[model samples]
Target: MPLILFNKPFQVMCQFSPHPSRPTLADHIDVPGVYPAGRLDADSEGLVLLTDDGRLQHDISHPLKKLAKTYLAQVEGTVTESALARLRAPLDLGDFTTLPCQAVRIEAPAWLWPRTPPIRQRADIPAGWLALTLTEGKNRQVRRMTAAVGLPTLRLVRIAIGPYALASHPLLPGEWQEVSPLEMR
Candidate 1:
C-alpha cells in the first residue's frame, strides 16, 4: 500500500486532476494511482492523506468510522465561554444536528505556519484561537458552527486525523512524505 501524508497549502484544491481555474493536488503531488482519502476546501489548509489502498481510504474518510480530526482555528473574536459551551453541545447546522465534541480556547500553536496571502487583519476586532476535535467531517462545519455562535472563523487548519499528527511528521505546506501502513496504524 502507498500511503502519503501531505500538508495541503491554502488555495490548493484537494483532487488530483487539473482544474480550469484553480490549483489541484496534481500541482503538488506526482505519485500516480494514489488519491486523496478526503478533501479539504480550497480556502482551507491542513493535513491530507493519499492512498492507493481502497480499504484504507474508506477507513480514513468514512464518517461511520468516527475518526477524530483535530483542528486549530483562528476565529474573528474573543472566543467566549458561551461560544465554547455551544460548540461542545449538540448544535444544529440547519441540514443536521452535530454530535457533541471537544472544544476549548488555546494559544496559537507554535508549529503553525503563516498562511500566504494571509487572513485579513482587523484594527479593532480581536481574534482568538481554539482547538476543536470532531469525530466526523462536515461541509464547512467548523466555520458554520462558529458563525452560528457569533464567532466567525478567520482561518481553519486540520492538525491531525486520528493518531497521525502533522506535527509528528514535520511537513511544510505543499510538501508530502511517504509512510507505512504500520506507522499509520
Candidate 2:
C-alpha cells in the first residue's frame, strides 16, 4: 500500500486532479493510485496524507474514528484568556455543537514556512497564535469557532492528524514522502 505524507502548500487544492486557476496535488505528487485521506481548504496549508489503502484512509479521515487533528492558527488581535476559555469549551455553531476541544495560546511556530501571498498585518497591532486540536472535521470549524469568540483567524495550518506529523517526516511545502501505514496510526 502506498502511504504518503504530503506538505500541501498554501492555495493548493487537496485533490489530485487539475484545477483551472489553482494548484492541486498533481502538481507536487506524481505517485500513482494514491488519494488524499482528508481535505485541507485552499486557504489552509500543511500535512495531508495520501494513500492507496482504503482501510488506512478510512481510519484517518472518518469522523467516527475520532482521530485528532491539530491546527496552528494566526488570529487578529491578542487572544484573551476569556476567549481561550470560550474556544476550549463546547461551541454551538448553530448547524451543530462542536465537541470539547483543546485550545491554547502559543507563540508563533518556529518551524512554519512563509505563506506565499503572506498574511497582511496592521503596523499598530500584533497578531497572536493558537494551537487548537479537534476531533471533528466540520467545515471551517476552527475559523468559525475563533470568530465566535471574537478572534478572527488570519491564517491556518493543519500540523498533524492522528499520530502523523510533518515534523516526523520533515517535508517542505509541496514535497511528499512514502511512509508505512503504521506511521499513519
Candidate 3:
C-alpha cells in the first residue's frame, strides 16, 4: 500500500474529480488509484494524506481511531484567554458538540509560506494565530468554532495528521511525496 503526503494549497479543492473553476488534487498529484484518506476544505491548506489501500484509509480517517489533526488558524482580532478557554472546552456548534481538544495562542510559525493572493488585511483589527488539535473533524468546524467565539478565521492550515507532520517533512504548496505506511504506526 502506498501512502502520500501532499501540501495542498489554499483554494484548491480536496477531490480528485474536476471542478468547473478551481484546481483539484488531480491537478497536483499524478499518481493514479490513490484517494485522499481524509479531506481538507478548498479554502484551507496544508498536509493531506492520500492512499491506495482502503483499510489504511479507513484507519486514518475513522473518528473512532482518534487520530489527532492539528491546524494553524489565523483569526481576526487578538485571541483572548476567554476565547481560548471556550475553545478548550467542549464547544456546542449547533448540530454537534466538539470534543475538548488542545487550543492555544501561538506566535506565527516562522516556516509558514505566505498564501497566494494573501489573507485580507485590515489596518485596525489585528490578527492572531492559534494551534488547535482536534480528534474529530466536521465540515467547517474550525471556522465555525472561531466565529462562535467572535473571531473569524482568515487563513486555515492543517500542518499535521496523526504521526505525519509538515514540520518534519516540509513540502511547498502543490508538492507531494510517497512514504511508507509503516511510519504511521
Candidate 4:
C-alpha cells in the first residue's frame, strides 16, 4: 500500500463516492486501489491524502492519531494581531473548546490560482492570511472558526499534512502523485 499526495482544487469533492450532481474525487483521481485518507470540503482546496493501506488511512485521518494539519486560509476582513492571538488561544466551538493552536498573518502571493467562480469582489473589503493548525478535523471547522472570529474565509488551502507540503509535492488542481514509501512516515 502506497501513500499519495494530492493538491485538491476548489469545487472538487474529497471522496471516490459518486455524486450524480456533483464532481467527486473520482472525477480527478484515476488511480485504482487508493482511497482518500481524509476529506476536504468541496469548496475548500489543497493537500489531500490518498493511500491503498487502510491502516495508513486510519493513522492519517484518525482523531486518535492527532496528526496536525496545517492550512493557509485567505480570509475576508482587515485582520488584526488581536485576531491572530485569538486564534491561538482556545476557542469555544459551542460543543467543545478547540485545542490551543498556531495562527498568524502572511503576505499574499500571486502564485495562487484563480478560483473558477471567483469569490465576490468587494472593492471596499479587504483580505488577509491566517496560518491555522489543528489536531481535529471537524466539519468545515476552519471556515467556521474564521467566521467566529469575524473573518470569513474566502479561500482555504491545506498547506501540509503532517510533514508533507503541497508546495513540495506541487500538484496543480486535479493532479495527484504516489508518494515514495520513504516519505510516508
**All candidates' lDDT scores?**
0.91, 0.91, 0.95, 0.85
**Clashing residue pairs found in predicted model 3:** none
For model 1, which pairs clash?
none
Task: TM-score each candidate.
Answer: 0.97, 0.96, 0.98, 0.94
**What does candidate 2's lDDT look like per residue over 118-162, in tens digits?**
999899987999999999998899999999998899999998989
lDDT for 58 (candidate 1): 91
Error at 130, model 4, angstroms: 1.2
lDDT of candidate 1 at residue 13, scale 0 to 100: 92
Clashing pairs in 4: none
> On TM-score, who's better, 1 or 4?
1
User: Candidate 3 lDDT, tens digit per residue, 42-146?
Assistant: 899999999999999999999999999999999999999999999989999999999998999999988899999888999999999999999999899999999
How do the residues 44-162 of candidate 1 rate in per-residue lDDT, one tens digit apiece?
Answer: 89899999999999989999999999889899998899999999999999999999999999998887899998889998999999999999888999889889888899999998988
- The per-prediction tally of clashing pairs is 0, 0, 0, 0
TM-score of 1: 0.97
When summed lDDT is taken over every stretch of 10 residues in candidate 3, the lowest stretch is 176-185
Which candidate number has the best lDDT? 3
Q: Write the per-residue lDDT of candidate 4 for residues 159-184, one digit (tens) a residue.
A: 88887887688778888888765555
| Candidates ranked by TM-score | 3, 1, 2, 4
**lDDT, residue 115, candidate 3:** 97
Off by over 4 Å in 4: none
User: Comparing 2 and 3 by lDDT, which wins?
Assistant: 3
